[model samples]
Target: MALAFDEYGRPFIILKEQERKSRLRGLDAQKANIAAGRAVARILRTSLGPKGMDKMLQSPDGDVIISTFSFFLSFSLANDGATILEQMDVDNQIAKLMVELSRSQDYEIGDGTTGVVVMAGSLLEQAEKLLERGIHPLRVAEGYEVASRIAFDHLEKISQKFEFGPDNIEPLVQTCMTTLSSKIVNRCKRALAEIAVKAVLAVADLERKDVNLDLIKVEGKVGGKLEDTELIYGIAVDKDMSHPQMPKRIEDAKIAILTCPFEPPKPKTKHKVDIDTVEKFQTLREQERKYFDDMVQKCKDVGATLVICQWGFDDEANHLLMHRNLPAVRWVGGVELELIAIATGGRIVPRFQELSPEKLGKAGIVREKSFGTTKDRMLYIEQCANSRAVTIFIRGGNKMMIEETKRSLHDALCVARNLIRNNSIVYGGGSAEISCSVAVEAAADRHPGVEQYAIRSFAEALDAIPLALAENSGLPPIDTLTAVKAQQIKENNPFCGIDCNDVGTNDMKEQNVFETLIGKQQQILLATQVVKMILKIDDVISPSEY
Candidate 1:
């Protein structure tokens, strides 16, 4: 476009405000993209093994987050995508894939997030070397695809059944422990793993191929030790009683889960009611009180010993219920009310007029436990009738620790759920990766040429997992890898993996280390696809073009 003339007849340039920033093209762009990926991988490299350290992230909002590097990376990427506030990197294909893999892995199997990111980064890093040797990206991608299929098949062959019989919870607990190994929850792995395993199993609906995670409520209080975390048979609400005079404990409690509020209903639209006389005002007060009284009476008539309200309970209703020797919890919300109904075999009555004995729920005990003071109390409704819902009470020393522990427990629970759903797992400690890598290389030899070279590169990329584990565990990566490879090759034991904590051993199975076969398969599929996508990207358009 040509320059435009202003009203004063002075010629002026017509262009966007030029912003100055560094630009890269061709080799520089590829290098920057790969470096960005490696940078993410490096952030998580140190937090890989059982002896891994935690990452402490402090945001600009003064919120502190203490979690594993995978969680931090996943969260950061999510925020970046949502806000789009960071400097735009049109060529950072690897970064985009890192986020995609982290999120999808997390959603699919809830573990192996770090492994996915690291392996994807390592694959691209390897591809960079292959590219230098004149191998095309298309050939690399094809080889990766072939190698991924073989790896999946190998994973299936090596996976073992994860049973949950009447007496054996070892496999399930071990799976939970593996998921928690690189997390802060490793500090209380045994106890927390047990809690996680039991929590998932308690609510697992295997016949339906579903595990209702919402049924397992995790309630955190910041005053006790991590060891204090325990699973309750029923729900716990972090709310105090509606009335001070109400009984704090009620055994053999007949519970009522109310959706309607025990108060005067407001007009749906704008309206005016004139109280022209004091007698009219008095009548209004009496009508509201009587309405609340009738509501409380209806609850009592339905054999309700405790009333849990989804909405507000007026002062008149509280006083009436308290005088009637009833324990009432108000403002319980819709979710808890639904959970309570599920736990106690109760039906939710939409209106107070519909109250009946059949709609009332039963609990063994309804008790209020005061934590710090009256203002900080939790209601524990324990021993519900044939309850499938349960609660895990999490206790920690501080806010950050509590949140981190919750995250770790969530991952543990998800892994347990995976085992319950699939009941198949592969040897951990990099055994699966090493075995798959070996198989991929053998398959690569069947197809000679540039494709074979790319296949070999993919095989080499699989070694990065164990290498990372060894490096993070303070062991020599080459030495450990050599020993593991020798054991697997000579003894023909796919279970041979580096026992990093033990220093010089290669028995991950005997050490009770395992990874969900589904998770590993997902990691491979995602990592390879991401690497292939990045390898095929030979051009990087400037952000301004959009």
Candidate 2:
């Protein structure tokens, strides 16, 4: 029978026959996987730093979610394009699994999601080349591994030793922020770092224990200049309650007084009472009075001087005290209360206090004004607190800009978190799919039990990181792979950005230099492996087939 053809008149029969051939091919899977990896990597490339752009994705339900790099990668796979890959019978499970692994790795490492994807693509490309060169997959994998180790060593040497103290933190943050883009992302990173440091310091006294808020202090509005107030004997609430009559100046005042807006007796309930319930009860006048008296007596026992109760004050809480002699002031917003508490230098929860210059992280706040007469003013409240209060403020001329900026900020934050917390993991931006391809390449090499292909596959996988970085740095994947090979041949450093000039030629580290080269080499290898997986998608089949 004559062979059938598709619209392009290609041999459909041969294609179908080839499809049925379960035996492994040299480069097909590698190419397809790499393409997929690169696609994902490209999507996130722009979302790098604070200057990075935001991606807005509209879901099938017409819900729009603003996205950063991490979100974009995740949503992209989960929502839209993933089904296409699955239907292609491209080992949907493996592809999804690998992409997830990449995302997790990126989360851990912070900055390399895009790099991972790009390098995976490159790896697949190189795998094809190696196969053509008559190099077995096993040998390639071995070579790639050797190269990756060297790259990693170089990375360690280049990474500055950063101390996690206040003095050293800023400089380290600055170094991390030193990127090609000149955007607020750097500042955001610094701010986040600072917040992290503060959290660390605040909790240093209570390591290996749950965070305690009791040590944190609360202040009253009347406590002028925290240092001036003395410990008062009773809680006081009074209207027209002025500062101490005898003490003309804050320095003259001897007592720390807390004034509130409510009546003399603050309500205390055996059970937690809702605010509305407290407001509704009319018969509890005596109960309220007793509450004040008890509080005052408690203060007096502690040697407090004056407890004044200011009842039904509009702006402040009414002071409740047992004794009549204590002096306390009351105002609105709990500002005075907070100030006095903080000024006392009492151990208090860190969040309640106003953010101070010293308390701010390495990145400072960036302010912008409202544009186009919008009533909503923009405030950028970026800070880097460890698990506490790091926030990104977005201000722009339009709603779109504000939203986009927020997305970018989120992406930057995620990247920074990953980078700071887990520096060891490898990330493939959108290239996780490429990592899948690299795995397939390994499988292909070992198909029908080719031991050599397996070793080569391992080597190629190792070099994924450097290749990804190079691609991110705008280097061509093929050239980078060739360079790695050349370096291996010459026994030179297979890594990029390594300074070997300091060591003497006779030095043992230099004698092998492979260890030094492995870091960069591994990066490239890992990246290429992913890239290859992303690129090749020629065959489309049902999910069950894979």
lDDT per residue as tens, model 1, 1-546: 337899999998653334212445555666677777877777666677786655666555555554443223223312111112122232456676677767788788777777888898898888788777767778878988888888899899988885575367888898888877766667789888999888887887868757889999888998878888889999999887888777899998888888876677778999999989999999998998887777777778878988888887656667777787878888886888888898888888788788899888889988899876657889999999957999999987876577677778878888988888788999899999999999888899788767888888889999999998888887899998988898899999999987877845587878888888898999999888887777667666566743
Candidate No. with top TM-score:
1
Candidate 1 regions with alpha-carbon error over 4 angstroms: 1-28, 56-58, 61-93
lDDT of 2 at 143: 51
User: What TM-score does candidate 2 reach?
Assistant: 0.42
Residue 304 shift from truth in candidate 2, angstroms: 11
lDDT of 1: 0.79
Question: What lDDT does each candidate get?
Answer: 0.79, 0.36
Model 1 TM-score, all chains together? 0.89
